[model samples]
Target: MPRVVSALAALALLAWSVPSAALQVRLVPPTPRQGDTVMLFVGGTKGARDVEGSLGGQRLAFFPYGAEYAALAGVDLETKPGKVPWRIGLVDGVGTPRKAAGILTIKAAGFPVQRLTLPDGMVNLDPQSEQRAANEAARLRTLYDTVTPERLWRGRFTQPVASRKPGEGFGFRRVINGQPRMPHAGIDYSADRGTPVVASNRGRVALLGEFFFAGRLVALDHGLGLYTLYFHLDGVAVTEGELVERGQTVGTVGTSGRSTGPHLHFAAQLGRARVNPPDLYTLPVRD
Candidate 1:
């Protein structure tokens, strides 16, 4: 069940009193499941210059949303179900910093299992290929570790491609050739070859590479520890460090990087947590 924290109770949890009526803190879905991106909104911060917070141990960068402040936090797919400690800090108009603490409740989520029979070469990598993949992965990790201290995206996020099938395959435990492999961390959209793929939101192109497993991919840094990835492209249209608008074409769908058919593998990461890309559209943000 979703646990909605009341305003007064939230103030008590923070153990602080404000000059205003009350300090309002809320988690969009109340109780979020694993692999979900949760929005944290803080009200009663009328003249605050900056707002920041941390969930578990991951830092969150808050941006101005109307009269309040909002930030996105990720719940890892393997996060344990329970209450996790969260802290928030804000600098008032006079540079007076105030702090608040609370807890975020997470709910358990069950992912479906998928079994596939692929060629041995596709299932296993050679020594040389293994090293290349490792290097690529490390580079991606380094990119995710760096947080841009600004909000570049506006309004809601959109799907990268048009697909008749519903969004699925995220967090799916894959058993390839009777051997368990890492879970699918992204949503796959079946599209025709050369189908244009657009940026899910506005951001700067962080990296573009032809990877062993991901094939040709583009990663977008949406600022504030939020990133969107478009993988398995037929071709790329944007360059690294270029600012792209929302819905701008970044690549084309194709059977690249271990894919069985033409498709676009879209993913989102908040800090270190791999979150569902579809969740971005559900956030309560507007232009």
Candidate 2:
């Protein structure tokens, strides 16, 4: 009887020593390239009440996905190719907070150079135009800094325009008017002027304005610090703060901005990272 009692005691001790649950983390792509959008999933969190995380110093906004929690994060176009640290925190059912850490491997992507010749006035802005562009740029930075606490998009994202032509020039280094300029942060879609442009997914119209460089622009807030921008529009169809649905027309394409021809400039931002807009379509978001 004593031997049996000892065996039971040992078994009980083993059970007591092991944790009931452990925190788990996963990145959908496992390995991502610069300018790619990543989907982060956390499991083994059966009793977790809340979850939060950060990647490369940028905050991640988490939302419940079935039995797990997930967030969308972006690797900027200029992010150096290497390992980036990521950390996660979880609040359990009884309010006990736990933490987990890992590294994300970012692969290098080659971006080709693009050269164009434009009017000198457009390439080199006048003093007044320079100041106006600077002011508008600052406003855009402020808008991207705000994070919406919930996920407002559903299912997969679609192309913003119906043109059969594929997007081009994302992350392209541009030499315009014989002067080097910032890398192109968005993709261009060649289409006829007044071609309908629709929202890639459900979102709220965040801003609509005419600017020195972007021309008529419409910015959409898709929550969780994710935004989509439509630039160089011939016309705007929605007002700021209006809730928009997937595939709804937000504007029409045109060469309103500093452009050689009629085309749509579609861009995306996750937090402050300028990610490729097409990457949004590959995410595993549910309807």
Candidate 3:
């Protein structure tokens, strides 16, 4: 049986108070078992026609209608054993320009699962470093959950006529100069340096900034703990709070942040947990 967890409990305990205009979110797992397919739902909406979702780096597409949009996405049992973050972005019917979003942090399962141990040097960093990391994680968790337009689920997840081949890997374990570094957390596409990068799905521009490590970073809130990030951009074309469509052009790829070459670093976060992006696309999810 799949274990069920409430997204609200996870978000609330972490101090992510709901935003006044935030979309309502729900996660309905079939049972209280690990590694089961779970359904994520958005309620109290209107004229929605399609949903665009992504976890880690994978993307999902399905049609939506009426007051709610629901999608069944697989949550891992063994990997990402902490709170799970899932993001969903929706668009209403034709010519109705609006989008809505929110986040969901699926509470951990009843039974614990063992995850790989990190080096003491990293985990046992100085108190300040550890605290900073924790704070950042919490902040990111909160931002991932609540940043969205007051009433719009902009974007669509359409099947690429010919799926663009992933130019680089997602979630690849990495070691820099023979020392371990953060695993590659996103998908890389080898497109022309200035080619316009499209919004993977409908979402609001919650964050568009430059960072030491992320270079030119752009975050899209697809609501419900689900967020998509684009990095190493040559230029960002959208402003914060702008509504975007699934295929809207937002930026171009570049060697920004800590990158060595021009490529798009596409990543997704569900609450705080980052899963395999490819899994989001290949997993057998239903609308």
Per-model TM against the reference? 0.91, 0.93, 0.53
Ranking by TM-score: 2, 1, 3
**Considering every candidate listed, which one attains the maximal lDDT?**
2
Arranged by lDDT with the best first, the candidates are 2, 1, 3
Better lDDT candidate (2, 3): 2
- Candidate 2 on 25-59: residue-level lDDT in tens? 88978999989999999987776876888998999
| Tens digits of lDDT, candidate 1, 7-39 | 667868576554434458888888899999999
Instruction: Quote the lDDT for 265 in model 3.
Output: 80
Q: Give the per-residue Cα lDDT of candidate 2 at 243.
A: 96
Residue 41 of model 2, lDDT score: 91
Candidate 2 residue runs with Cα over 4 Å from true position: 1-17
RMSD of each: 8.7, 2.7, 15.2
Alpha carbon RMSD to native, model 1: 8.7
**Each candidate's lDDT (Cα)?**
0.89, 0.91, 0.58
lDDT for model 1, please.
0.89
- lDDT (Cα) of model 2: 0.91
